[model samples]
Target: MRKLLLLLVCPLLLSAQTPADQILAKAKAYHDPQDIWPTLETTFTFKETRPDGPDRSTIIILDNGISYMKINRNDEEVYEVNGEVAEVLKGDKDKARALVLRNYYLYLWGLPMKLYDKSTPEISLAEDEKVGDKLCKVLRVVYEEDTWYFYIDDFSGRMLQYKFYKDEATGKGELITLEDEIMVDGIKIPQERSWYTLPEMKYLGTDILEEVD
Candidate 1:
């Protein structure tokens, strides 16, 4: 009788740690050094050399928790992706621009500043250590039925990488990985990035940033 009682109480004695709390703690510990991220917003330039391509021009802009974005590419048309087709542009940089913007927004906007809210579900630590040099805390977020995974830097509170996945009958889920970092003006930046549609084939992309502050 005592053994049964103890066994049931063991779980209750264990601290209730949710995924969101785990991620928040990890990020806070990692980024205890910088306040720069709180003001992150600017245009990012992409020097694209993908799966098998030479190079191209691309630019992305993000402002105010990233409610808006604009893209311009050398050989592509400008099309926006914001839970829907946001807009279109007719210019030489439209295609490449839109591609970069879509990918960038997909990669960035899916994160959390205050995750205790109900919008993010499955808030706990996941066994996802393949995204970066340090261990990553995966936070499963859901807003209005749409969900995503945010990979945070364990040693630095900054969000160094993010991924979006969806299961479909015809097409498989895709994976995007961020890596090859360099510090520019005290801010860590991604020097090289790769995207895998089937977790096999990867498209290499570059980020060239210029400070405007």
Candidate 2:
């Protein structure tokens, strides 16, 4: 009876240790070891640089526990969204745009921690691949409209790059590469995010985290 019990438990353990689960767990441990991101409240100031235009600075405040976010662009109040209500303080009163910004900022910064959310899309593992010269483990997440692939450093488990595609067959989308990091509110946030066109690999823009308070 003891031998049978051991045999049953071994398969359960092996099955539970999936490649996707292992990669995500390692990444979450590196980024937010204390698991403090879900209730995190903080401010981040960053600059967006592009070859085609002048640099722009933006400030974003996020309080996830209360589902609140506010964005300021170029020293002007852009919008703030609290729960279901969006207050547009500048520019056109577009509630949808405000809400989109709220989600985009929160999700992009939250990263591996956000992947743990129950409402997040399904996640699976792809074969090991290389981004640049670093060997990475790929995590494929399927959303409602598009699919995203995240590449995590094989050794350190840090997120190195990610790409999104509306249609995988077309191979037309953008790839965002993460570099450097900053520790803010006990969370390891990427300092530079460089964007490039997929396939063509044309340089687009980069967002650099300038300060956090």
- Which candidate gets the maximum TM-score versus the true structure? 2
Across residues 1-213, which tens digit of lDDT does each residue of candidate 2 receive? Answer: 999999999999878887888899999988999888988888999899999999999999888889888898886549989997999999865889888888888888889788898987778998899988889999999998888998989998889989998888999888999999999888898999999998799999999999988
Cα-based RMSD of the predictions, in order?
Answer: 8.7, 3.3
Tell me the tens digit of each residue's lDDT in model 1 across 1-213.
Answer: 999999998877555755567567566444423534445566666676654676777666654354566666664655554433366765544345555667455344323443433434555455666453577667665445344566786666566665554543333445556565555334555555565664444544543333323
- Give me the displacement of residue 92 in model 2, in angstroms: 1.6
Cα lDDT for residue 39, candidate 2: 85
Error of 1 at 173 (Å): 2.2
**Minimal lDDT window, size 10, model 2:** 68-77
Model 2 reaches what TM-score against the true structure?
0.90
TM accuracy, model 1: 0.54
- The regions of model 2 sitting more than 4 angstroms off are 1-17
lDDT of every model, 2 decimals: 0.54, 0.89
